[model samples]
Target: MSNAEMILELVRKNNGVVTAAEVTQAGISRGSLNHLVNSGLLEHASRDVYQLAEVWDNEMYQLQIRYKKGIFSGKTALFLNDLTDRTPIRFHMTFPLKYNIGVLKKQNVKCNRTKP
Candidate 1:
C-alpha cells in the first residue's frame, strides 16, 4: 500500500485515531500527517494526535491517547474493581512525580504522588 493508504489503515486500527509516534513506528513519514490534515482526511485531536473527520471527540480516548502513563486510581479504581457500588465522581491519576499535572488539575482530576 501507498503512504497515505498505510496511514489510513493505521487510523482505522486505532478506532479512527492515531498518533505521530504510531505513524512513524509504522514506517510512514511523520510529515505525511500534515498532508492528511491539509487534505481534510484527518483533524487534530491534540498535539501530535489525529483522528478521522467523521469521528466524534471522545474524552476517554483523549485521556488514554494523550496520557499513556496516567492510571485510574482512588475512588475510580474502587468502582472499577467492584469494591464499591458508588460511582467515582473523580478520577485519581498517578504519574511520575516530575510529570506536569497542571492540565489534569485544571480538569479537577486528583494526582497521586506515588504508584501502587
Candidate 2:
C-alpha cells in the first residue's frame, strides 16, 4: 500500500489518532503526513499528533497524547474511570517526581508529582 494509505490505516487502528513518530517508525515520510493533512484527509490534533477529520475533538485524549508520561489523577481520573459524574473543571495529571511540568503548567492542567 501507499504511504498515505498506511498512515490512514494507522489512525484507524489507533481509534482515529496517530502520531508523526508512529508514521516515521513505520518508514513513512513526514511529507506523506503533510500531504494527507493538506488534502483534508487528516486533522492536526496537537503537536506531532493527527486524527481523522471525522473524529470529534477530545481534550483528554489530546492531552494524554501530548504528555505520554502523565497519568490522569484526582477529579480527572475519577471522571475518566467513571467513579464520578461531575466533569472536572481543570484536568489533573500526575507524573514522575523528576518529570518536568513547566509546559503543563501553561495549559489548563493541574500538574502533580508522584511521591517516591
Candidate 3:
C-alpha cells in the first residue's frame, strides 16, 4: 500500500492517533504529513501525534497513545482493565521514577512515576 494509505490504515487500527516516530519509521516525511493536513486528511491533536479527520472515537486513542510512554494506572488503569463502570475525565499513567519528566502534568491526566 502507499504511504498515505498505510498511515491511514494504522490510524484506523489504532483508533485514530499515530505516533510521529511510527510515521517516520514508515518512511513518511514531514512534508507528506503537511500535505495530508492541507488535504484535510489528518489533524494534529498533540505534540508529535496526528489523527485521521474522519475518525470520531479519539479519546481512547489519545489515552492509549499517552500511556504508550508509561503504564496505565489508578482510575485509568481500572478503566483499562474494565473494572470501572464510569469513564475518567482525566487520563492517568505511571512511568519509572528515573524517567519521570512530568510530560502530562499540565494536562487533565495524572501521572505517577515511582520505582516499580
| Model 3 lDDT, full chain set | 0.75
- Output the lDDT of residue 61, model 1: 59
Tens digit of per-residue lDDT, candidate 2, span 1-116: 99999999999999999989999999999899999999999998889999999999998988988888999999999998899999999999999999999988888999999866
Worst 10 residues of 1 by lDDT: 107-116
Winner on TM-score (1 vs 2): 2
- Misplaced by over 4 Å in model 2 are none
Provide the TM-score for each candidate, comma-separated: 0.75, 0.93, 0.77
RMSD, each candidate, Å?
A: 2.8, 1.2, 2.5
- Model 1 has an lDDT value of 0.84
Clashing pairs in 2: none
* Superposition error at 55 for model 2 (Å): 0.4
Q: Superposing every Cα of model 2 onto the true structure, what RMSD results? A: 1.2
RMSD of 1: 2.8
In order, the Cα lDDT scores of the candidates are 0.84, 0.92, 0.75
By TM-score: ranked, best first: 2, 3, 1
**What digit string (tens of lDDT, one per residue) describes model 3 on residues 1-116?**
77788888877887677877888887887666677778899997777778888766466566567556676779987987899998988877777888755656877767778887
Ten contiguous residues minimizing lDDT sum, candidate 3: 57-66
